[model samples]
Target chain A: MTSDTALSVVFGDKISDEINDRVNSLADSLKKSGIKGITELCPSYCSLTISYEPDIISVNRLKRKINGILRKEMSVRSEDSVLWEIPVCYGGKYGEDLDDTAKLLGITPQELIKRHSQTVYKIYMLGFLPGFAYLGGMDSSIAAPRLSSPRKRIPAGSVGIGGQQTGIYPMSSPGGWRLIGTTPVDVYNLKREEPILYSAGDYLRFIPVSEEEFESIKLQIESGTYTYKSDEAVRK
Target chain B: MIEILRAGPLMTIQDGGRKGFADKGVSQSGVLDNRSMNIVNILLGNRKDEAVIEMTMAGGDFEFQNETFFALGGADMGAQLNGAECRLYTVYRADKGDKLTMGYAQKGCHGYIGFSGGIDVPVVMGSKSTNIRCGFGGFEGRKLAAGDVVSTGAPVSGITDNSYSPETENTDEIRVLLCAQNYMFTQKGIDDFLSCEYAVSANYDRMGCRLEGTAVEAVNGMDIISDAIAFGAIQISSDGMPIVMLADRQTIGGYAKIGAVISTDIPAFVQHKPGEKIHFRAVTLKEAHKLYRKEQKFLRKLSEKCQKGR
Candidate 1:
């Protein structure tokens, strides 16, 4: 369904691997088409919003162009997607709300961490803030609701959970999610050619680490010696 | 170099804005009233995308260390160059050590000041516009303040005495094109939205302009899958108040958008002050496109005239 000016191509009503892959494939083709007047192509969980200039191309003409591209049936390129293993320290000062969140879920802090790190999550989209990835795939048993009152400042690299979704805070900002852990890696560094570490459709696996390991990794990152591992194989 | 003596509220350097970054969740932060910004740049024969200082309701005081040609546009902010009254949409030469001061806006909310050679700021993500929320782009990724000196690019020739004054229209009527989610609103809701008069709420800013009026409730709920937001998206909050998203709005929003105000009319809409009554009128997409093309034609002719005045 498209707006009068912007075109929003929705794949399905639910969030599924098939839908995400289709969305990614469609986005890739539209980008490869090199359509003129397209200012931005914002891809979310199940839809892609194409913001274009009406002066350069009328909305009806652009829609027809997009429809023609869709009819060509592009396949998702697995090479474009990457799988990352992020290290996290899930307790103590780094995760201020871990114990409270675990108690609310009727589970021990260790159990909560185990459940969170065990699942391979998918990066549904990046929104709310710059480089903040909206992640999917979390154990329903450990689902936690957001805080009634949001914090004034949640530190950067904080892994949090709100409702059924789990994500990492790329930058320090006010948030209502319950913080469960912190990552030493800089997921959003503006100095890099690609500011965001991950893109939509990328897979993420959290690996539990100790506070001492977190500090050591933080030092390694500051020294520019830390490098993240990426696997080309896409997990089903 | 121009040094800020008194940086007024919410002053920032802006250009055409950082495009192609919305996919990464970056807002396209730029001048609120782009028409005014373009006119100021055109008057000085500066590049269309040259960065200019966007002043809000209250303007500021600055001292130039060198001679440079400058132009002012948009709101009548009572600008004075070296203690002499300066007019909007007119080019003026400022001598070394000249002090330029401006008072509160007399009519509209935004005012623009353009230098002969755009304001020199490092382009981040391909834009000089400031996104204060993300703290990147524009002068150090923030608003201008006291004691800050800003550089200017090399001046271009062919600066003319060309002046443009946009024809003032009825500010109360804002034209909108129905969006994809128009079916979500009941007929009564749609009628109420078009018929009722809305006042600009006090809680308006570069991000969005909130309007206080009769609730335009959706037949269905207001929640929807998050989608990209355009410059003039009219999103209805859960409370049913309409918020016209602007340049500094987030790249995407979850609220159901009823429609979008046409691009050509956005300049006049932004100039409106809080507590001012505004009404909406529906226009077909074709009509909206025609208005946009007409404005582009006028701007092209104006640019040509300025170039010929060398």
Candidate 2:
């Protein structure tokens, strides 16, 4: 058995699927094993970074311990999930790149919008910035490349798709993702007891909302009374 | 109180560092050169986490509005008290109206000036370190300039000669850890990364230091997705040169990081001014940890010695 101090190691390149499974398993392991020193475990597509106290266990040895458990890792069965319905108003003022993306795909803007919104995407990761979600499972027909030059500043809650991945920018930042729509839902709110609206492994379904509904939801969120609901996950 | 008579580009006040704030998308904005920052604190007989002034490569001039003791460390910036040459990593006394001028840095880019009692600055997110990205901590979230007067809390004593001097083995060659992403590059790329000499580009700051070197290429087929990045991670850009992210590096990145400059070597690497050639050689994570632990031990010893001196 490897010492608790050894650093955990994961194998191979592009181990996204396996990495995600290992992360969920490790969370259970930490709880059941009563492990000490770990303050947090942040899991990504390919790696899980466990932040711990140096005095408890040095990073060098901790990495080895992680690699040890990964050798005989048990498969992580999918857990019950709450499907979050995000209402996004597409095109016109909300989406600046919708028309250009439609032209590139050689399809009408309405067709592009319908194709883009049809699928229920999974939030694979939440990173790059505060509250930013890396959502996967987008239609390839409407897939578009990032802008040659990124916009200097993209507003918060700007829903966009880059290549096959779609995401909602949770903060104002420089982004290359082609903006297709805007969501009034506050993806991140510091004032809220829980700042982030979505977490990794959650499901997100984009439901088209009217401009009037977008305004009403925005005001409700600002006033702090917007209640979010979850639905049954579509079985694989 | 000490007044800035002249301030160079990117000069700011710094303390130990601000850690544990990455979840908020805030980088650990602290003194880029940690060794020198610690040395400055030791010279003044101050605690390890005391606030100190961090000056960049260009140099700056300051005046003691009141008689105070300060110590210089990090770069051999040729600091002078009233036009007299002073030694690096030693405490010196300056009286009121005495102007201290910093000449061009000879070996390093940053120089630290730690006051006797340490500067009294409001701590933001549990640090006095300047965060230039979010514009939050240190001097109204901005760099220092001429005429800015900073006050110290209380006076500390300058004691023995050893307490006023630096005691550690210093080297120029920076050691690093070969990253897991090293396989993304070709064999020649790895060879070039180790053998080829690179100069520090002028496009450098707290965020990262870009190296101007021979093109380091990726393998015929390898593309990397963004992942968790830390301080000292040497990320090779699409243009093929390496950029070592420093205090204010983004929490995550997409660029392939072939290696990370060991934490111990980062102080020296930060001191190398533009046009100075730097070479890279990789070591195991154990070796890297050894180096890091060695520095920490040295720093603790230095602090202990300083405390005993007073």
Candidate 3:
């Protein structure tokens, strides 16, 4: 029990696929249990923090329910992960640090994009801003250092690399992550019924597109004709 | 409709905030001072958690389109109705075209003004509170500007003032509870964090405020796998400086948080302006919950009284 309204259930201290799987599974189980007054069930790297309404359900009763759920064995789920094939334009004005990042890694821009787009990254959580997805799993060679001075504003849909994790900016915000590409898809949209396009426990594969294709997609989005390309990913 | 004659530095309509969207990376953006927000609503006999204009630092002037009863809560801004003295925590009846002018906040940083009915803003993601970072909700997902006309719902027939005066004196002391990653820091680091006084840095905003003072050394380093950030959580960055996470804080973060300020005292903690000093004291959860319940009971009683008066 950390605070009065919220409680943190820690699986482990380190970040790993096993720990994240457990965290997500527990979150789904709790949501399915039809528990009343559970406001937010936030699943992060290795823990799930639950914020509940104290007036609806007392703190002691909420603790007992959580403990009861914890007594059950955690199941690793892999079938429901949605694989979003994102269209990205790499190595240009959209990604200012592409050349510098490749130079630091002693690899060509072609090589960097090859390894980056090849792997299927899993989304462990969403945070830092509206609709910001924390996509885990990246090529070890693609890791880069944070900028000394964070940019005042990074445009939305900018794909950046930070340490071993890579993610899209979701919205324009001040950030220090090294930008390597930009996606044409609107990951976070206010007009849409569901403001956030993606969700945690999903997967993403970056598909590099030409400048012309990026413009076409943007026009399609504006004309209200574009639909996100995604399918349920079968876990490897 | 209320036409804004003069827009101050920052003004927005905030309610109880969006609650269920945190898992999707949406932070709860709401009024910083709920004590004041609720008191204003209760005073107006409006629904609890109704959207109200949150005027920060400097206040603004507006003209009512029709007759309505409005009340001022939270910080005192030397409000005047049609160029006459107006008091906080008291309901005032305004005629059509009556101009309400509010000056700079005399004591605290924010002021809440509640009309008979709540403001007429489309409910987005279960809240009318403005998520300024995301640029949605509130008035066009931005702060109100001069000449902008804002609508209000049908005013309740009459006003009910319980005549409750709230004690809102600013204090430098903030009570906290040790939790989360407090064990990550050294004993000396923890002692320094408690004993030393920290000044509120200028990097203060709706998201969080960075405190400039003695750095709390982390025994296992300051980095942690990003986890859900709570309002009033005191996070220690790599440099060891503490940043108090607030209402508009990101849903999750990677910094190691040593403790969280008690929920009840958050209204008082946010009053300190930049350069003002703040001291931290650790208290038991029992003590924290007692104060929280006390405030909740007070608000509940007001709502009940308002219902009966109506």
TM-score of each: 0.96, 0.79, 0.93
Error at A151, model 1, angstroms: 1.3
lDDT of 1 by residue, B82-193 (tens): 8899988888888789999999999899999999988998888888999898888899989999999999766667684777776767877999888877787888888999
TM-score rank order: 1, 3, 2
lDDT of 2 by residue, A1-236 (tens): 00111222343356354465555456445545545666544445655545554555677456566656556654342454457889899988899998998898899988987987788776655666656767667888888899999999998889897887788887777889899899998887655665677666567888888899999999988887888756654432
User: Mind giving the per-residue lDDT tens digits that candidate 1 earns over A166-228?
Assistant: 989998999999999999989988787787888777889999999999999999988888887
List model 2 lDDT by residue over B97-130, tens digit each.
9988987778678888888889888777668887
Q: Tell me which of candidates 1 and 2 scores higher on lDDT.
A: 1
Task: State the C-alpha lDDT per candidate.
Answer: 0.86, 0.74, 0.86
| lDDT of candidate 3 over A139-208, digit per residue (tens) | 8888989988999999999999988879899889999999999999999887789889877788889999
Native-referenced DockQ of model 3: 0.63
Best candidate (score: DockQ): 3
Clashing residue pairs in candidate 3 (N, C-alpha, C atoms within 3 angstroms)? none
- Fnat per predicted structure, each in turn: 0.47, 0.11, 0.68
After the best TM-score superposition of candidate 1, give how far the Cα of residue B117 lies from its true spot, in angstroms: 1.1
